[model samples]
Target: MARPTTLLACCKLYISESRNDAALRAIEQAARGGGGGAVVVNRFTDDAYNRVGYTLVAPLTPSPAPPPLRHAVLGMVRAALEAIDFGAHAGTHPRLGAVDHICFHPLAHASLRHVADLAGAVAADIGDELQVPTFLYGAAHREGRTLASIRRQLGYFKPNSSGDQWRGAPETDALPVAPDAGPERPPRSKGVVVVGATSWVDNYNVPVHTGDVEAARRIARAVSERGGGLPSVQAMGLAHGGGVVEVACNLLDPARVGAEQVQGMVERLAAGEGLSVGKGYFTDFSQDKIVDLYFRSAANTEG
Candidate 1:
């Protein structure tokens, strides 16, 4: 297979928790060896949420454009489901499954349509073979729905456990929204997965020096587009397992309102509550850095 001159695209797999080192290793090993002609470019693990984000890059050339981005993700998801149990999970981050969210992004040469089809195929395979319920969003859906809209229907924003945290699988066996693929009822051990394809999105988080989650939530709302803050910005305030709270944000349109804007807004909001703010950081690498990592990892694998 010939490598494309430009990095093709990336699929980000979000796992629920990282406490199980063996499970984490199994998933990472599967991703690295998935042989989908893809490379694992970055791995970001958050201890507070116990969530792990793995980004895999593929080549744009080579007729099929390396359909293995799906292959790689499928293997990782299988390993995750086999090793982890949603019923035994507890985290500050809201998640519905052992293998939670799967989002595909076009990096350099790949188009949204291409990754959308790929995401659909992966969702189908996961549903049919793995028997895991899957929901489609972004370009993966015929209507180009948003993930937040679907999550809202599933009651994902409410914390099922104490202290504004999510614990175990969802309480009900039935899902509010019928899955685009898979069985009607979500399994207790596996739960349901959300899969989608969209253009690049930035995952940025700003930490506040206080442990007051309510104050953080207020700041988060005031800084989010839904709350009439910046446009294309979604914010959530949550306890980060320390004497800290984070205003976790998804910058849907970073070019228009990026981290700088978010950081400034968070700082201003924290000041009102007499809370100090820490520097905000991104959970993943930049496109150029990811491409460089892909080249390096692909070469190592080829060698």
Candidate 2:
């Protein structure tokens, strides 16, 4: 069979493990090998959040053929599951598992359906082989579920331990909803994983110069779509270091709503509360930027 032209698919993994950079790097290396040359576009680690975000891209295998992206993601998850213990993990960010969340995005000419298939395959592997409960969201979900909805159902916002810390396993064997893969009950230590596929989205954060988390939460509500703010936007108020709060936003459609608009709205709303807004920052590179970097690295490797 002839090999199809290469297309791009990006995967983002939110891991509960980040304190050890070397361990994360080892997982990334294993992921690259499983990806069959997937590029690591960007990685961000937060000590406060006690989490890490890894963005990787690989060429999509032809239709009806097993794509390396699935293998790549599973390899990373396996490494994470082995190295990280969620029972002793704690972070400000809401999480349900060691490998908390996994999202796949189609780039270039790749279709959403293609990435969705990859998400499903990875979810199954993590659930069955690893025996961790896994939920599907976004395009990979038949009901078109959203991540926020699933998180809310899982009591992610609530801290089981103390002071924003999560310890032990999930409280109940009976979850609000059945997982798409794995056992209905969550296993010890690993918890559960949320896997999905969607279009390119930007995660932007704007710092608020105030210790009042309530004010930040209020601003987040005002800037979110549910709050009748911008279309295709989601916002959250998070506590940063040094008495500073942040308005973290997810731009679902950059064409519809960009960082500038989010920043403007946040600044305007924060000013009403006498809070000044700092410059906004994106967590990862844009899809176009990632693709360009991938090609450049590929060229350098070949040369």
Model number with the top TM-score: 1
Off by more than 4 A, model 1 = 1-7, 61-66
Task: List the candidates' TM-scores in order.
Answer: 0.96, 0.93
Residues 38-143, candidate 1: write the lDDT tens digits: 8887889998898999888886545654376878889999999999989999989888888999999988677898789889999998999999899999999999
lDDT, each prediction: 0.89, 0.85
lDDT of each residue in 143-232, candidate 2, tens digit only: 889988998998886767654355656767678988999998886678899999999999999999997877988999999998999999
